[model samples]
Target: MNRLAYHQGIHKFFMMLGLALHISKPVWKHLVHLVDALTTKRFSGTLTDVHHWSFHPNHRTTLSHFFTKSPWNEERLLEKLQEWVLRQIERLAKRTNQPLFLSIDDTICQKTKPSSRATHVIQGCDWHYSHKDHQMVWGHSLIWLMVHTFTQAFPFAFRLYDKKAETSKMDLAIEMLSSLKGKRARPVYVLMDSWYPSRNSSKPA
Candidate 1:
């Protein structure tokens, strides 16, 4: 598709998505610009990068505040997204007689070590052992859950692994799974790495 047509198509898609999610039109307009910037090839996932790449006239600060200060409830958005994905996949899985699959994994987003003199470092960033690198890495950690059928996959849910929080990685994994309880009619096979198959996790769900 031509650039203009592609942009228009994306705009319409997000409009329909926003309506389904019950986002106010004004918030959806700004949200669409942010989403547009995110989908761009050269755009990095940052407020500054989003503002630079987006076609909207809003300043960078406005974009930042749109997240930090906006009254919109992100939890609501996520819940709606998960509900929509479940509906589509559940329908398709039944039609194709495909058993659903759920996978859980965690990853570390490594960031530069903050200077010793720096008083305020990024919140929720800490040193965590990287199984891939076999060493401690300083960054935020995240755990994600994805659901899939034979032909398609969806990011069902995720949780940031906060060391300071009361929850363990296993607890977070179980929590994400718990949210999906009683929501699916199809048989789902849960998949995880060797690290996740502990005594607690080995128990029948």
Candidate 2:
């Protein structure tokens, strides 16, 4: 299908961004197909070979490679997204008098199977204790920081939580909060769950 033509509105917006400049044509083609498949409610399966022929000439293997072992800098893309989101927020903040709410949370995303390819190959996929599931699940641990205005909650900065990484979630939250040192919203209030508290017992949540 000519998804670009089919979804011209979204396609034009994506193309207009400086973010689109970095992607090569072949990679961009697969990326667009993946976006189309993912956003559609009916085609909700893993981007594997089952739906490969339905879209275009590229195989599922090619698409999988674009996610993993690909040379693309997803971090840079995220930074671009951050830039774009803040610009939108700036427009809305001028109209609202509410203090911006910066919320932080972490969740466990369980894998299909313990030893599945996703658990092995996907970045940040691992064993984590899921309080929601009440089990040790093999999958990704994800943490995100979101900005909540009166009408919207925009999840902007997200990072994979790996205990093997450089720092703890507490540290990362602090770092993320620090990044908003001089936001247009004054006195940004941080809303975190019970899990996050000062290590010292004497302090309040």
Candidate 3:
């Protein structure tokens, strides 16, 4: 199915759930349209279907503008979304005997243009011969904590680390571990590469 149809279907499904009655149906639909446009690869467009709902032709709407106009506060929305996701996960976990596995890893995405938002990010030391270019390039790595159960994988946390940063990947791992310490479904094991060895690391595997 096309992205627009898929997104429209999802919005309809969520509306049927009746979580909160305070939000207007039109507004909720617009929010869903905006979110799908921003996050999904298949739904790429500068102007969203939201433009169709607006009467003024000259006005253009962006994701940032949608958020600003949204009645639901960002923090509360995030918290509620997280709670719903966790509930769904717990339901699935109860159906299986296997324990959840958490994996931590970092990756670098090389960018040609520098970002004003990239200040204080550390530069990378030459770890290996560059495959993309002959010369070494400054790279920033981001650490992510992901959980795997029998049927699904959930990403719980992410942190960015530069080579010149004071904190190490180990530090980021520790932070991720600390964050998950008291979860209802405690992870059975944490998997990591040789860069994070079991012998020397303070975090449990």
Best candidate according to lDDT: 1
Clashes of 1: 0
Name model 1 segments beyond 4 Å from true. Answer: 1-7, 18-21, 195-197, 200-205
Q: Candidate 1 lDDT, tens digit per residue, 1-205?
A: 2345655776687655555457766577677677778888999677887877766677778877777787787887777678778888899999999999999999899988999999999999999888889899999999999989989999999888888777788888889999996856889899997657676643111
Prediction 3 global C-alpha lDDT: 0.60
What TM value does model 2 have?
0.77
lDDT of 3 by residue, 106-191 (tens): 76555444556866543452232244566555554577888677689777777776555577778888887776535576347778
Instruction: Show how many residue pairs clash in every candidate, following the order shown.
Output: 0, 0, 0
**What does the lDDT read for residue 171 in candidate 2?**
72
Clashes of 3: 0
Give the Cα lDDT of each candidate: 0.80, 0.67, 0.60
lDDT, model 1: 0.80
**Model 3 segments beyond 4 Å from truth?**
1-31, 42-61, 64-78, 113-140, 181-187, 197-205
Q: Of the candidates numbered 1 and 3, which has the greater TM-score value?
A: 1
Ranking by lDDT: 1, 2, 3
TM-score (all chains, Cα) for each model: 0.87, 0.77, 0.57
Best-matching candidate per TM-score = 1
Model 2 backbone overlap count: 0
Q: Give model 3's TM-score versus the native structure.
A: 0.57
